[model samples]
Target: MAGSNKDIKVAVIGAGALGLVTLKNLLEEGFDATGFERKSYVGGLWKYTLDETTSVLPSTVANISKQRGCYTDFPYPDDTPSLCASSYIDDYLQSYADHFQLRPRIRLNTAIRAIKRDDANNKWHIEVAPTASASDADTETITFDKLILATGTNDKPSVPKIEGMDTFKGQVLHSQTFKKPEDFKDKSVLVVGIGSTAGDSAVALMGHARKIYLAHRHGAYILPRLHNGRSIDHGLTYNLMTVQKLMQRFAPNVATNMFTKFAQKIQDTAFPSIHEHPEWRLSPAPSLRQTFPTVSDELIPGLESGDIVSVPGLKRVTGPNSVQLDAPKEGDEPMKLDDIDVILFCTGYVNDLGMSLLEPRVHPARNTNPAWLALPGSRGKPLARLYRNVFSLDYPDSLAFMGAAAFATPAFQLYDIASMAVAQVWGVEAHNTSTLPPKAEMERHVDEQHAWILEYARTGPVYPQLTKQFEWLAWADEAAGTNVGANLGWGAQGWTFYLRNRRLYKLLTSGVYTPHLYRIFPSEKRKAWPGAREAIERMNQQLEDELKTKKV
Candidate 1:
């Protein structure tokens, strides 16, 4: 723990949003951290790829948001649009890396194959291979005191294997494969999935596609991006900072109920008036989807003009030029479309950490299902068994996967937290206590989190009422004594004030507080409790009077 800083060597995989943030933090903390990006460029998914036509769109490769998707610490420039193009985001990321002096540490076009524990030296042995085009043919193994896996979730596009997907001759591609609306211009297109990606993609194609069908297996709770000429996401932000605290304090059930009710309210407000058909169908609101910029203002009118047809789930891809849809309502006849020229599946991605490394321990017969692990990879071996969503306890320093857990806000925030924790364990920091969580406890926590997500999803979007999941994550990180607390832009006092002063006065008066409740309080003890409290109260009164008079 007392070693010189020169002794530390950290390698971060994936130089995307999460990777870049981790690299920034590591550099700030004075650690010798290097980054490896598979792409020749810095931005991962933000790097735009084109379809046959060249119009910019949110295809698998195009950048999504420029300003909205960036780090909270470094606000995107004011000139940037809310929904930024992919190129803008890439430029922003490159600028961020440059600003933080992280460019020198990055090794572009490098790919990490496997991370194994070198038990003898208490270090990590990471196998590195250049991308196909790299001049280096042989894979080289590098040893590091610590390893951070920021390889984000977006790298792998989720394309479900429909029975006759390959038979679709006209064109079949995942949302990732989409680049411009012109590709679908004057052509019939079927956009599959109800998640934000699918929704946005469908909206984008409305201008060009001759006939656009937005299909989903289940109904999703549709809420407007704006209400009454104001941004709905902004309202959610305000409510998250205020209402959530009040509910958690005075009435827990009431707070939970509010999310559902609010979501319903938003859905109601969004339909008929804003959206053409508000009552089409309701599905669970995808939390990750909220992070992306909602459909732009220019596109909303078209959505209302009936350019986009909301269709039920896909039954099958009948042929190269046609597809079938299950009726939206039960007992209704199936609808077939014979002239569709393209199908874009916006189905979700699977979290698969390639299982080539842990073969013997995670063989199929062992019943180590990857789903059981919570972090996907091989069957029988759930990644949840690792401590703090970090190292595998059974395989000491063998592997650590960052940015695995799905979060509402930027995954980079959590990745940064994970990276810091890894740094602490590696003794790269002055004081290291990141490995405190026992493997068993970490596994239980992950299990509970998964259970919570499944139940939340099953129940449907708790909108307006549901606590912003990111806030809870921030609190969890704080309790774990991680850097997430510092990264929390606003102070905890906002929610604390709403709950303690307004909603649940009884609990505050009763002096009954849960252990979780105490984590938010300052650690210092008050001396001369009654006198100190009275003096503080007097100062508050004086401050209030001066503010009332508009005099500081």
Candidate 2:
């Protein structure tokens, strides 16, 4: 439906980081956009407040990379550090919302129930439910020309069904329910899983909990936030996109090996032999050699001082107050702890799109495994075939899923790219609707792209290489009718490349052209066309030469 300004009415699901950014970008582009947040507040997972069940203690919040996470047009405050807490992020989003007058369009405490396409009118019928705790509730239906699912996967915590979990007398909760470290003060606590949150939560609860047992079924690479007096996270955040590209082009194995070694070191120093855990499955993301959370100066001394202890996975919970562990060292008999006040299941969240409005489009066959297709669905029909991770093949002028990948760069950056693509789609269709590609052709293209990514991931890192971001953007921009090569120096890559390339100071913000443009364009174009197979083979050879010389 058209709005007062002849703008397209768009419904953005999820008001967290991804949603907030998507909504803001849409509004900025003169689109009549409204946001629906399941939670009462903003900031999605980043929002932190006191809860009676869990006490607040000194702990590091989700550290948003101001350089990478903030909008390109808006710079983060200079005073802000590389890592800021959830409160800081919440405040930042609020300020952005206020600055752009985006609050009025957002409907807080509103949850989306279903989204159905009206084939007759070529519109999307969205069903939204209020967040009020009522069993028999009426849902409000709204129609919009476009729908954006910014509902991030991280927002939902995945709780695995473990044997004898419910019988435990001690409180068991997901990391989402965890408020602070003080709640486990002087009590024995067992933390399950070993993702970013698990690492951060374990470190935070070190001193507070009398005995902290970190249960990991398998080994994960532990990266420190800082290395050589510089934030490794900064390197990862700022240069990750480029580094990923370099790795993809030159030394795929070297790139994977570098991160594997780094994770091994962290395992050796902090929790030796942890990688040998029977349940440890290698991560799909490219390994960061020294990428660990930035432990606050105050917390490091305590960790070394023996306040926190990392253990293997949880074997079983014998009783309400007692638990057993699959200890790291052999001959270290089955360890048991008592009087456990709280058990923080740092186990990760499941990305179930069918649970949300993306269900109707999901086919039963694909529903069994959503991650397999990189599309959101459970079992039935496919929602939309992904085109280079952005546009959908089946729907004309429709692009809902981006930043839906299980683990990659933060969802915020992906949302930015998606918004830009959406705007482009709107702009392109407004001019000539006939230029759009056929759905069948687009589907084949997407299937090929997915196959390529899957093969690439198998030979390389577990997660999409950082370089894939640039690659995807280039392809997406082209598909959206924008000149990615020309926009690189003007968009996110412009600032990013400027920071890393010392020779391009004059061209940094001048919008001046660089010679790399010529080299990059041909390489990207070759990768996009039927000649990509030969291009990739040639690129692999070049990468080997570069890696042998660099010896990284």
The C-alpha stretches of model 2 lying farther than 4 A from their native spots are 1-7, 50-58, 62-64, 132-138, 236-246, 258-303, 327-341, 353-355, 358-366, 369-385, 406-410, 428-438, 445-470, 477-484, 487-552
Across residues 1-552, which tens digit of lDDT does each residue of candidate 2 receive?
343324578888877767777787677556778888766776665556564212123455544355445653444555666566666666787777787777788888776776788868878887777744433356788998877777665555566556677669988888777876777778777778666677677777865788766666554454455444433443352234456567856996787677567545654455443344332333333334212232333233333555655556677777878777776556868766666667788755454332355544532124322454343111121223455444555564654654454334445555665565565556422332223467777667666655554554333223221125556655545543333344344577656655666453333223211111221232221222243223323333443454477664
All candidates: TM-score: 0.73, 0.72
Reference-based lDDT, each prediction: 0.55, 0.55
Model 2 TM-score is: 0.72
Tens-place lDDT per residue, model 1, 338-369, is 98888888774433433343334531113433
Q: For candidate 2, what is the lDDT?
A: 0.55
